[model samples]
Target: MVLLLLVSLPINIIFHKVKLPSVMGFIVAGVVIGPYGLKLVDDVESVNHLAEIGVILLLFVVGLEFSISRLIKNFIPLLAAGGAQLTFTGLAIYGILSYYGVPQNQSILLSALGAISSTAIVMKMITDRAELETLHGQTCIGILLVQDLAVVPLILMIPLLAGTAEGGSSSVGMAFLISVVAVTALVVVSRLLVPKALSWVARYGSSEHLTLLVILIILGAGLASESLGLSLAMGAFIAGIIISDSEYSHQIFLDILPLRDYFSAIFFISIGMLLNLSIFIESGTLIFTLLAALVVVKIAGAFLSAVVTKNSSRISFVVGLRLAQAGEFSLVLAKIALDEGIFEASQYQIFLIVSTLSMLIAPLLIQGSSKWSLRLFGAGDETAEGPKKSSGSLKDHVIVVGYGHGGQNLSKVLNEIQIPFQIIELDGESVRRALIENFKVLYGDSTRANILVQAGIMRAKAIVFAISDFQATEQGIKLSRKLNPDIHILVRTRFAREVEELTNAGADQVIAEEFETSIEIFSRVLREFKIPSNVIEQQIELVRMEGYGMFRGISLDAENLRKFSTYLTATLTESYQVSGECWANGKTVEALHLKALSGAQLIAVVRGNEVTADPDAAFSVVAGDVLVLFGRHASLVKARKIIEIGDGACEKS
Candidate 1:
């Protein structure tokens, strides 16, 4: 493991720096370390299992992030483009294979494989390029999502098809029925049982417990599908959809990230292991032919799909070219077909060769799409009409930089409140959607001065830097301040240290999400201990005030530090409050022998508005006084009974 990491890590780092997909590095690493090369990975089966895990996790995460509502909203375009692409590509490939004299069954299997593009590779590339939220990105992702949804049925049908005699009936009636029934059962169980089960586990308030529950749900669902002779990926995808709306979704994603990365790496490495260099070297002509066929079929299908969606020729070409690659899932399909005896060994080899080459050339095709689109169309031409210019002054309008989740939410609230605003988004799809909704949105990057001006930033009352990229946020702040020195800039960030930088760049307020979340978690912990509401509020206020902007640098005085320490101690105790009826209630500290309560320490007595700190032995306890005690969790629970519900020694009043 150490050796593999040592060899692959540097390559990955270099690839990332150069802005190339890391999958390329993984492939190269695997090829170099495999038996045919340096012979580092001798255990082929272990490596293959690791790779399979990677594919599973990759699909699992995709399912988790799938937005069904968004997909349904754009259903017409997605279905139209996706269906056209798949049909045309499949038919084109099938015809070509037949012309080349390939067997009927093998040709059909190849066609199905060709009909799909790599969701894993394409998504990674789009995300790395920061284009997943862009117009082309959205269109590509939407189409790919439809394809993924289709793969589940394809996997099931492959086995049935393989079992049919040559030239016999190709009836898929039974498979379809079973599939529908399975889907219905999954939906019912997920809707009725999964949420309640998850809620019960979540009440424990343990991160570990939540993580375990999430994994169990995913794996359980996956195994259930497998036991019914269906694809595990289908089950995993369904599981993702079920949990996507849960509060723990993001946390679950974070928890499973390590597993995803590890498995994905193995998946790529396994692909590398499968490649036979000698086969390629000996059949150069065949390899090129297969590669050319795959590319042409994919591009043709994508282009036709784009046209059907009402896109212009230029837009269609760009979309087609961007999607002209066989993705990771294609390989999964090929493997399944091969295992089911749907394709001969030689045919499977050809498909793998074609798929890998397509992936290798995908980056080049995508990189040139923008420039090519402009050349095909006209420079500076908006496919849809540009936003209409305002007839009156643009002053007092809010300038929103980014139309993502946070930006969209803010815009919705602003609209409800009747606030005029101009939104600037770099993504084409987001801009397109906004335009369709008749929103005052500009398609451009806010970091650029010209784009900001186009969005009426100069006359804006406040600039909301809602973009997640920190460097981009800083740039926007600097540009906005330079253009309008008096404008208020509100920036959102994930780190506290970014506040100072943003403020220095002329931001009026910087909201750090991580810091805010941490404070919220701390507050909840305090509340669980039954701390007085006012005390908790005061501590929170102090933390927020001291933690924001320049005040973060100043050290607290001794008195304030002591106070903070005391609050922290009280917050950590699980159950430190005792009811009035407890044996220790109305008993002086000396009389109760407070030292005997393991790990317990009395901090103060809250009697109405006055607080008694480190009280003397004569400090008599009042019935209504709330005792502030600190101790280990178990000790705190025992002490809580004395101050809260009271000990069993209480008599009826």
Candidate 2:
């Protein structure tokens, strides 16, 4: 265990710095330190036991993140695009392997393994680029979701394929029955009792206890499945799905993440330990051939599937390239095949090297996919007149990108004010919603130059990007600026850190949710303390002019700092209601010597809806009178103290 951690830490860090996935680093570390390389760790059995736990935790987390609502929401892509990609890729590999004289069952297993794409690498890259909400990102994720589900049936097929079971059909039927009963019981218990148990634990248990409970649930499910002759991973996955619908899913995932990473790393390293470098060196040609076949077949399958779902050719091709590699699950399936006697040592070595190479270059493929697609298809379907042409010729209009909350609100105000506006949306569901409301929405990615042109970018008065996808927003801003140099561009970002980058990308104005939320909070707080509305507005304007610099710890010049200090302490009005217990219950304004003591003036005094403006020295103050004082902040504080107590209170201070 110590050896695994010591070897993986620096290796993973180096990989991370080089912009490679840590999974690859772990695999490489395994190969370097395994018996095949340095012989640092030759006891594979002990490591494999720990690695198995990693696989279980890995699948458990996958289930926990994959909520049922998400499945239903993406059902179309999951069924249409995902099903097509899987069928096409799997069939192509199967045919190739079968033609080479591989046995039927072995071909099926290998093809299934080859059909899967690396969810870890692709998700991390898209998430890092903030493209998860982009059209192609969603399509890629949907395909991965389907592949994750496919693992269950593949695992179940292992024993049957290996011919290790006793009664053939009867054994299979009995096994299926047991599996069904076990899964049903697990779901029922999770739905009916696990939530209540979790609630009780959360309410009364310490955080440590909560952690232990979740760990128990994961391992207990695994044990139950193993006892019933099912895979531990399958049982844990089912448990995760049941808990995913509950509110505790995210918290549980967060709590288990450290363990998952640790174990998953070990699992990958163990797979590396199985590698035979001698075999890899001898079969270089075969390895490269298989690698080429894997990429081409997967890309073709994914591209065709995306096209069948009506995705633009550009988006389809990009999605295809993004998924053109075998993933961690493929390694898992390969290990099972090797253990089941389906793959010879030489074949496993070849498959392992091919899978590792595919993952190593997966990020580059995804990063270059857009440029590749554009080169191949030359603007593709984005140039087609989508909803933009249907909206008719528009000029001096506003172009809104992403029909999300910001876009919707902007559209509503534009309509009320009778301003001409057009919306460019990429999400199918969002586009449908906009069309339902009779919005002049173009259904395409705004990052495309042709899409911007179709939206009257050259003639539009302004363009606003209210999308959460930062990469798309940045790209759209640059494209819009390139299309129309004079058009005003506004961008909204979730974090203030992204403001400068978006500005550099040609956004005329950038509003960050973080700083705006901070400003709103401080504004409300000042209002509660009776600060004048005009003064509050001034503070807000000053902050905005400085680009929210104050909130982000940006240093201000002495001149600007002095100006802000003056604005904050500038003379302002603050009203204080006189109480019966106050010292000024029956005193005249002049007799109180208000200005002499606190340097504040009693500008107005209200008594029973009768207000006295610029009260004279003779105006009397009493209980229930609302004294409106005007002065600097410090002066107001002193004046309020004198009014509440006696002027002697000010003298003592």
Candidate 3:
């Protein structure tokens, strides 16, 4: 165990720095320490046992992340794209395996494995690049979600395919039905009971006991599923989904993450231990041949499936490459086949080699998709090429730099308002999409003056640099200024610190998303006090005027800090509309004297379209009058109580 950890930690960290998945690093460490390699570990049995627990735990976490609600919400994509992708990919692989004279069961297993992609890897890349909400990213995720759901049934089919005593037709049928019932009961019970139980534990149990409770739930679910003749990992997944629906899911995920990552390393390494250098040496040709075949099959399968679902040819091709890699679950499936005596040592080694190679290269494929899409589908031009054509026909258009999330949203708004705009984007896919949507998008780096001029920089009403890359945005700002000094320049940056830097770079209006987002949070916090929208807007403007410099290096002294806090938490003025059925509806203002009882000052009585400010003692409370009351939170509650149920609900008011 020490040797495994010692080897894995450094290797994983180093590979992670080099932009490769840590799973690869752990697998490499395993290969180096295995008996066939360095003989550091004579046997990997104990690690595999630990690795199995990791699988169940991580799958449980995955289950928590993906609930049935999320699945059903994406049902359209699941049925249309996901279902098609699986069926076509499986058919393509099954046909090839059968042609190569593979056994029926083995071909079926391999085909299913070939059809799935690594959800973790793809999602990480998408999120890191901030593209999870993009059409391509959303489509990929929807399909991946469905593919993950498909794993449950694949595992269920394992015993049936293996033809064990439990795999008899009637027995398998009964087991399947029972497993479905068990899963339903588990989800229902979890929703109805897990939260209450956890709340009870939280109230009485120590932190350690709470941790033990979570582990027990995970393990208990696994045991239950296994007892019902289903996959323990799948049972754990169901348990995870139950917790996910509960309020405790987030805490449980945070608690289990460290254990999950450590054991998951061991899981990947177990697969790596299967890498026989001997097989590579003797059957190098055949192994690479199989590797090439695996990539081709998956890429083609994804592409064909996407095409059948009416995804554009360009999107289908790129999406196909993104999903070319075999997943971690594929190894799990392969392991089951190996343990079931369905695959010979040589066959398992070939699948293992192919799977690893695919995973290692999948990241690169996703990262380089823009360039590949350009070359493969001719959807866009190289960045060196400026605008495909002159935009002389359009006058005073908005020029958007970088067609990422910010640019996309800005362009969408502009297009909706019938504002003339042209986009300068370096990403081939973004350019293709823009053009497809009938926008005047140029394929070039905006930092280039020539590219900017070609995009009508001189005549554009405004130039917006909306990309996340700071250096690139700075360059674009400087270049735009040098060319058209009087142009309206708006720059969007990620960090609060970038606000001053971007402003110095000559932006007319600089929006720091981080601080602006903070403003939003503070605004919401303020609104909870019933502070008016106009006040919130004023506070947000104040933050912007100061460049939200507090986030950078600006500091408030103790007195001023207290003053600001007081303003933020000051007495709020709220208006309560008088209802006809209320006991205080027709009472005299002197009798109700709310200021004396609830410490709430009636600032105004807005009756219909007229306002009577500071009503005197002779005034009568009437229905249809909006009493604008001003007070601290506690006083406001009393004022509301006096108004809601009359003076009877309040101690004095």
Candidate 4:
């Protein structure tokens, strides 16, 4: 284990710098240090043990992320898509292998292997690219969830496929039934005990105790399942699902994250150790040809699955490309196959090599999927309901380019005013949300030129880039400006450093979160110090006019600071609402003698929107009247007390 880390760490560092996935790096590290390469450590038993733990942890985390409620909620739309994907992909692989003289049972096992895509790799890549909420991302997740669930049945099939089950078909069916019963019982029991136990630990135990308790639960569940003829991975996953519905699930996930990552890397490394490099060198052409065929078959199957489930052409194409690799579960099945004599040593080596290569290529495919999808599908709107043709009828309208918080608020304001506007969002769920709210929203990547054209950017009066993806925002700014030279482009970025870059990319106005937050902070501070509202507004206006330069480290001129200081210290006017129980309510201005009592002049009294300015002393004040007073800060403070509680508090003031 120590040697594995020493070899893997530097490789991972270099891989990170080159933008390669850490999973691939760990696998490569294993290949280099395993017996076939450098012969650094030939003993494999200990590594395999650690690798088993890693796989269990990996599945546990996956289950934690995939709560039962999400699975049920997404079932209606995603079920057909996910099921079709697994079925079609498996059938295609089975057919191809059978045509080549592979035995029926071996072909079936191999097909299962080819049907599942690497959830770990695909998810990590999409999350890094910030596309996990996009249509294709959601589609991939749904399909992967189906694949993960399929692993159990696939495992059960292994004994029957290898002709090793004592009761043949009946045994397999009984095993499936037993597995289901065990999962249900585990969930029911954990649901009753886990939450209360966690709550008690949180109330009375240290974090270390909580951590240890969680580990105990995970391993104890695994051991229980193993004792009942089930896989440890299955029990860990069930444990995760049960805990996911609890309030402490997120905390548990965070606490176990380091262990999960550590074990997961070991698992992938063990996978790489199983491959024989000599076989690859001897039959390189055959292996490459097989890998190419697998990629094509997987992509085509996934694409058809999406199309069959009524996804738009763009989303379908992208989903196909995104799921073109075999996953960790594939390795588990392959190992079982090897043990059952479904695979020879060399054949297992080939499978391992092909699977690793496919995983390595998945990230590149996902990163370029949007552009490839646009080219293939002609940039049609990919909405949750299906493709909708873009209209050019929208003229001089605001185009909000994301459906997140900023975009949602902007759309509401535009709708309230009855302004012509359209929204372009990539997130399928957000697009659905916008539709539910009756907003005109188009689902597609705004960074793509065709998506921009489809949104009628040529006729847009203004476009707001309200997305958090800075790269996409910059590209959209440049593309929108090119399409509509006269249109206003407003952009919001999270960092001050991005302001100059966005401006150079043709954004007419850039709002940096850093500067805006600082501006708001200072404005509130000024309000607390009794600066008049109008004066604060002027300061805010001036700050914006200077492009937030003052907050960005551009020094304010001495004269301006002096003027600001003067405003802070000058006599100011303030308005106070008269409550029914106030001392000044129902009192004549002359009788109250506000000026004499508090040394603050009553500049005006507003009654039901009628203003009595500089009135004679006979003017009467009433409840609900707004009193406008002019005075120094200290005098205004004293006058407010005199108005609130009569002359008894006036002496204290």
Q: State each candidate's clash count.
A: 16, 0, 0, 0
Candidate 2 lDDT over residue span 1-653, tens digit each? 89888988899899989877676778788888898989999898898888888878876777675555555577776667887888988999999989999999889888888899977667656655656556787788788767765666666777778887444645544555566567667667766866787789989988788878888888888897777656677667767777888887888989988888788778778767866787778888888888899999999989999988878777788899999998777887788888989888777878888987787668678877876776665332343454243335888999999887788999999989999999998777778889898889998777777677788888899999988766567777877887789999998888888988988999888898889999999999997775766778888877776777888798666877788689767637788999999999899887777789998888899999799899888888989999999887767877888898878967886
* Residue pairs that clash (backbone atoms under 3 angstroms), model 4: none
lDDT tens string, model 4, 1-653?
Answer: 78889999999999899977777788888889987888886887788789878867766776676567665566666867878998899999999999999989889889988999986677656644555434576688788766765666678888888888655666655765676577667767877887888889989999889888888888988887776666687678777877888788888889987888898788767767766788888989998999899999999999999988767676788899989988878987898889988889888888988987787677678767766775666433346764344576999899999887799999999999999999999766678899999988987778666688788888889999988766567777887887779999999887787888889999989998878988899989987886667788878876765567777778777877777777666648889999999988988888777788888899888889699998787888899999999998767877888889876667874
- Runs of candidate 2 with Cα error greater than 4 angstroms are 45-67, 98-106, 123-134, 156-189, 220-254, 271-275, 339-341, 366-390, 393-398, 404-421, 459-461, 494-497, 511-554, 557-563, 569-629, 634-653
Ordered from best to worst TM-score, the candidate numbers read 2, 4, 1, 3
lDDT of 3 by residue, 1-653 (tens): 88899888889889989977666677788788886688898778887789888778777777666566755555575467887888888998899989999899988888989898876566546644555434456567767756765666677666677775355556544654565576667667766777787889989988777778989988988887777655667677778877777777788888987887778778767757766788778888987887788788877878877777655555677678888888777877888878888888778877877787677677678877644654455323235665344546667889998787688899999999999998988655577778888888987666556678788887888999887655556767877887789899998876676788888988888898777777778989987776665557766765666677666667645665565566666638878898998767988788786888888888889988999999998889899889998887668777777877877667653
Worst 10 residues of 3 by lDDT: 373-382
What TM-score does prediction 2 earn? 0.76
Give per-residue lDDT, candidate 1, residue 182: 80
lDDT of model number 1: 0.71
Whichever of 1 and 4 has more lDDT, that candidate is 4
- Model 4 lDDT, full chain set: 0.80
Q: How far does residue 590 in candidate 1 sit from its true spot (Å)? A: 44
Return the top candidate by TM-score: 2
Across 1-653, the per-residue lDDT of candidate 1 in tens digits comes to: 67667778888899889977687887777777876568888888887766656666766676566554665567677767777888888899999989989778777767877888877666656654555444566678778766765665576567656774333233344554566578558756876777887889889658888888877887788888776655566677678767777777787878887888877777666666666677778888989987887787788899888777766565577778888988667787888888888877877786777677777677678766765664554232223554334344677899888888888889888988989999988655677877876778876656555667677766789999887655557767887888789898898876677777777878877888867787788879977886655567767766654545224566656776688777756564332334556566667777655546445677788787998887888787766777777666555555555454444312221
Q: Worst 10-residue stretch by lDDT in candidate 4? A: 378-387
